[model samples]
Target: MSPLNMFSRLKNRKSSATASQHGSLPPIDKPMPSQCVSSPPVLPAATMHVKQSLQPAAVMQPKPATAAAPKPGSTDTVRSVVVHAKKLGSGAYGAVHLGTCYSTDGSVHCVAVKVISAERMRLESLSREASILKRLSRAGHPSAVRFYGWFSPGSKKVSTDATGPELTNLEVSHCLVMDRLSGGELFEYVLARKGLSEREAAPFLRQIAEGLAHAHSLGVAHRDLKLENVLISASPSGDDICKVCDFGLAYRYEVDGSGKVLKGRPLTETCGSKSYAAPEVLEGRGYDGFDADVWSCGICLFAMLAGFFPLDEATGADWRFERVKLATQHRQSATRTIFSFYDRPCQLSSQVVDMIDGMILVQPNRRLKTEDVLQSMWVIDDTIKADYADEYMYDEAPRYRGQAGSFDPNAVSGYGGQQDMAPLYRGAPAGVIAAPPPLMKQLAVLGQ
Candidate 1:
């Protein structure tokens, strides 16, 4: 009796193991306890049950994912998608990585994912950028770097390329998804060439002024205007265009109905790279952000033309800056005040010096404005001007369907509560700049 019972049990166990060899599945009648959670996805096989023999074949199978019928959390839904590949750059707040994303239309694209730490940076910081980028992206501004959607992946697991303060709320968040500016940073671009000639540099300046004009026209001030913050990207024309990016320190100023920054209510925040900061910003005084941006532009122009920074820093403590300050206070000319520090300076034309002095003036009241920048001798008189580069910045996926003519606000990221995002593609780039070309020639050359 004992031998018979033992033999029967062993045979039963062997049959059970064989049945599961083809797949790790529970018996039809006794599913595992884990197959209960509703939110997280479950295997189709786990949920499969024998249907009635008379039921139709279509009811027994799953439908393919398309706009007509998409599963929950499907590609049609808003997602914070990122496939971490390699590190691109990092900052005090977090790191930026190259990532792959699947668009709603089933297209795959390479996107720049900026992973930020909430502990080091506020959610508002990224939100503000998204807001500004949404506006600029809708206009399809070629001189400004485009922004994709931002997401906070509240996951306890650290990402392969994620680096910042330890995760707060047990998850790391992505600040924004953006088009990869393949041409690299402006600092590296200029440094590689050891500087650019006035003829060569004029294009870059013209593009920058155009971008700045747009931002000013929208009542936005790029507080952190620096070489590192600006990027170089190629347009469809294969000419490199300087695109202003990194709007983390960007400020939204009070504006009139026309979107111009209003006077009187000066900004009190002293933010921006030290070398590029205006004297008022350094002195902790209320200053017009638009005016400060112009001052920074002057410094950038000087650096590009001379292939070196005009001064290490713009504070009175820096002797070189102090000389410029003294000269400015004395109403001296920009050439004598700025070039005096160099033993042998490049021959910058009087037009160049005057332009620099126009914005780099000591007093904010008399500082050059952004609109005036485009009208400057080298910009307006120059043969180049930046045309609008339009693209679908808010599509659920990359809009490769080919939109022609003006931007259609109906298809932007802000539409339908979608996050801001756009893929870099080769589009004709027009306007005032030229350099070694790089990624995404997708911007449409408008009014060319």
Candidate 2:
């Protein structure tokens, strides 16, 4: 069966009872809230099993836009830009449309214009997102989407009624221009393929890891990492290149202060797709943005390989919590059960299982960091070896050093030279690496 058909069947199966009571699913275009509240406390390694209460949502009131001088390298101003009538997609903030930008020399280029309504999004949030995109653009990672510029249409151009004016004449509150990825969303790509083999999925996963590693190295954390947010490139053959996009929930976790790695105040806003969120995030505890990103990556990888979520709320309960509960009951058995949840038991290799295990561990402190993931056995296996060896495999920018708002592209070279690991093994030799302590403790806790 086609992936779309299969997904429809699965979705129908999950929501059938609810549908009978409520009629049907809500409209797809329903807008989500603009802001969400997060708690303050990092999930320490020692208290892995403790449950935390959910925090109240913190609403960030809209702030008026301030008039300020444009910073160096900022494309805050443009000579002429035209947004096309074609709508690419829409979300809580706004809709995206195809656009054309013209330069002083009369050069024209196609771009994606993300238009946000003035009423729904706060100016502060828009500005923050713009800054993050600029930083990502400066970092120059191949897998990161390129940022063009942003603008807001004047009142003369905006129309409140659809019958009042054409879309071209409608005034927008904020418009961010970026390179248009023609291959569409990663979710669509996955749905088209149904499920991918380990070999087929490795390169895409590696590119995403490299992108995240580069972002983390620069102290940026993508709080909302999921299949939907990833954009696939139009590749003629082999796997399509994945570009990390949609910085709506992304934040910089560290400040660039004279070569020092200074931590910014921890983010306390709980926002992200629930399925891909780290356990701590769902529990309403303050969490490391970087660590949460790694957890989400693990979830994405699981979906890619299994063609279904490792744990789904629609499955009648919180799958993650249940998995933890099962692991507490029987550690080894639980791990195997979770891994085999989706049919295709023999398809996964030991290294693949180990890598996922390390990534999605319940303990945030014990979860594999982006750097460790890049070096993981699964990522380095033969399937992705050539791509891994490519010059752009790793970002070369210095993590926390550079002038404010400007990156020195030549400041650093390749990742510190590291030798390749020996050929892939079926699994690590017994006792080569010990099992995680947290998992063992959970088993003990449940036994009592």
Candidate 3:
């Protein structure tokens, strides 16, 4: 029997069961054969923690030991973690550093410190992020990043003397100390290889799917499922070690008695990068964060395979930019496109493309779930797991050595480049979790 025939038969059986549950039997025109295709295992219990050593198969070794430990209540704790040299970097609203912490009892550890402005912390978005981090840390979600805690370096003593108000009184600034994923963003790794072949990308994709599977099991939806937000963990084993970072844009759902709609803080503002936005979100219709995340995951897969935005316009100057900007800004107004934006013909195999098509479905009701994505034919191939043995896990770039106790801007490599920090600008208010846009009114993706 063909794949479609098999699927149709399964659908018929499922429909029959639904009719039977309702005390009636809507008959099928033809009897279907039974099959025993295996499904991936369901994620473990909410309280369960994933083992620490799980890494992706594509990676073969641990990252270099430049990562630093958290400082003892210092501003540079997460921002400038210097294990041996100046492995420091910065981002919007904060600075990041590589450092090693030596405990009073002689124990040593490595960590990353992120420094955020108090003013920015007041923004609802950032505040929600802090809350999510704290909650995930509390829940011990394996896919979530490990948040050490929050700190305010200059809150205790009012010492201002660095010539400028911004530079002076450093203690006033708030900082978030988080476990740094030394492997950096997966985008960097994929891009570094000048894009990966399908054989090379499959194992990498599986690792991320496992993380998402774990998150889905815990009822968490990482709404912003983009390349930048997916951080590779600092582990020798690559497949099981991918860390889904930035839960600041995520949402947790609880099903009610009827199990129709999800109850939680509704996100009024549409969040996340525009290109990866799901079709329903773009159309100003109601959506679920979970469903949208799955869609974004499919898009990420497409990008990993094709090296371009799935919804991008082929040959226009800022053609999709305005639509994307509006879609991102006006929570209720997501524009719809007919086909994926690509410069070349689609290159993935039939099964892989079939799965991607399912994920990119415009209607939330028809999209693929995290579990379904994991069960793709490509994932079932033994070669994917086998190939992991040969990949380069930690191919570190050039080093940025700097003197001890002195700050050097040019030495470290930030996300964008040297000096590429998130610009210091006032953002959305803190402590307020914005309601999801009308399109995302229902918790759509949780079940899938």
Candidate 4:
């Protein structure tokens, strides 16, 4: 099936499910399918016993639940996790909820549990995600989410009316537990601000770049890297630390004989959210997963700075592809066109524009790698000067700053002026010019 159709079906399936019992399902304690069992094993539960090994010593640790050691070879036990009924969020594969895990000795640790029913199990992908999370946790990448562990209940036969072949098996549920991010989704945080200035967004962008660099270094590609998946962790001092989450679509392309990561193979799947997909991915051809990730990061950066998608779907059929094509035809003119969409002309620094250009380059081969992005002048300057230190390190209720009492989403201006530019491009190759559509449509579609 086409990517769009498949995505739509998956989305609809999740949306139609009853929300009252968000994660209420039969336990999947029984053995999973052969495919799942055969996947890479997660780091043993014993590894988690050493808290210092999992995170930096300076970082506060989750309070332990108990003082007792678990039985050898028993059901992997370190803590007992409870999933609260309050829904944190839901997606194509499952829903997440506020949860708490208690150590055997009686300490509580806050967490988010992503519950997936057996029916929706993309067993292979889910298994891969679990393995990747384990690797990330082991590496101690501060920006990546902490993977506590996952659970699948065993299979058990159930009787329907106490008479049949006594052969009905209850569908099992899978749960992935991770750190609960109280700061919420990045996109909503940005929208609430009307938009963030370049300085204001730099620190967050740096954190994301660091995370991506770590993942790529391990030859893992986050196929779906968008605003929503980037969670925020607010320190008591009000600093926001980014934590990239949701590895469900992550792919490990390279690994050594012992299964260590190394550069591996190219990916062909046309997966990921439509808006942030790179031009090559949208074209439905096999593409470099790493480069595609960079492109998505570029799109994300643009949204953080502009408060909207740079090339929205409503611009026209194949808008992103067309824009890229147009850009290739007239680089300077296209740059100007893009620049004009900003709220204030000349607001974006040259270094920032250069970095974005490198990332969003139409040719994947020419696109900036995550490491290159981290080393870019714009990022370097921001890191050194730290002009936005206050915003980055101590702004209590940061997400609510511009969104509180007096905020007005509709009153936001300097956007939507391009909505009337029908036939977004013209045949004139010299330098065709036409404004793109407003970003409101893109946001609306995403909300749906």
Clashes of each: 15, 3, 58, 17
Over 4 Å off, model 4: 1-77, 104-106, 154-171, 257-264, 313-316, 333-335, 341-346, 383-448
C-alpha displacement of 433 in model 3, angstroms? 44
Which lDDT tens digits does candidate 1 get at residues 1-448? 1111212322232222111011111213432132111111111111111112222333332211111211112223223455464677766667777876656566666667677766666555556666776666668887766655655555322244435433232254554667788888877776655556566677888888888888877777887777777788887999888888777666765555665555444555556765677888767666777788888888787766554455545665554555555455545555444443322322555445556667677777777677656655455444322111111112221121113222333443232222212211111122211111111111111010
Q: Pick the candidate with the highest TM-score.
A: 4
RMSD of each: 32.3, 19.5, 18.7, 18.7
Top lDDT hit: 4
TM-score between candidate 1 and the true structure: 0.63
Q: What are the lDDT figures for the candidates, one per model?
A: 0.53, 0.55, 0.46, 0.55
> What digit string (tens of lDDT, one per residue) describes model 3 on residues 300-360?
7766654434443111222333333333233211212111111112333444555555666
Q: Clashing residue pairs in candidate 2, if any?
A: 37-58, 38-268, 158-171
lDDT of 2 by residue, 121-168 (tens): 777667778877877887778988888766665632222323323364
**Compared with the true structure, what per-residue lDDT tens digits does model 4 show for residues 1-448?**
2111212222342232111101111222443233221211111111101001223345443231122322211324335666666678876556787777665676677888777766766565456667777778779878878767766644221101223321122225667777898999887787767567777788788989999988877777887788887898887789987877877766676555675654433455555665677867655555777888898898888778655566643123543445444544444322334544222232454455556666777778877788777766567655322243334323311121222123322322223322212222222222222332222211101111
**Candidate 3 regions with alpha-carbon error over 4 angstroms:** 1-91, 101-106, 123-127, 138-142, 153-170, 237-240, 254-261, 264-267, 313-345, 383-448
Q: TM-score of predicted model 3?
A: 0.56
How far out, in Å, is residue 179 in model 2? Answer: 0.4
Candidate 1 Cα deviation (angstroms), residue 156: 13
Order candidates by lDDT, high to low.
4, 2, 1, 3
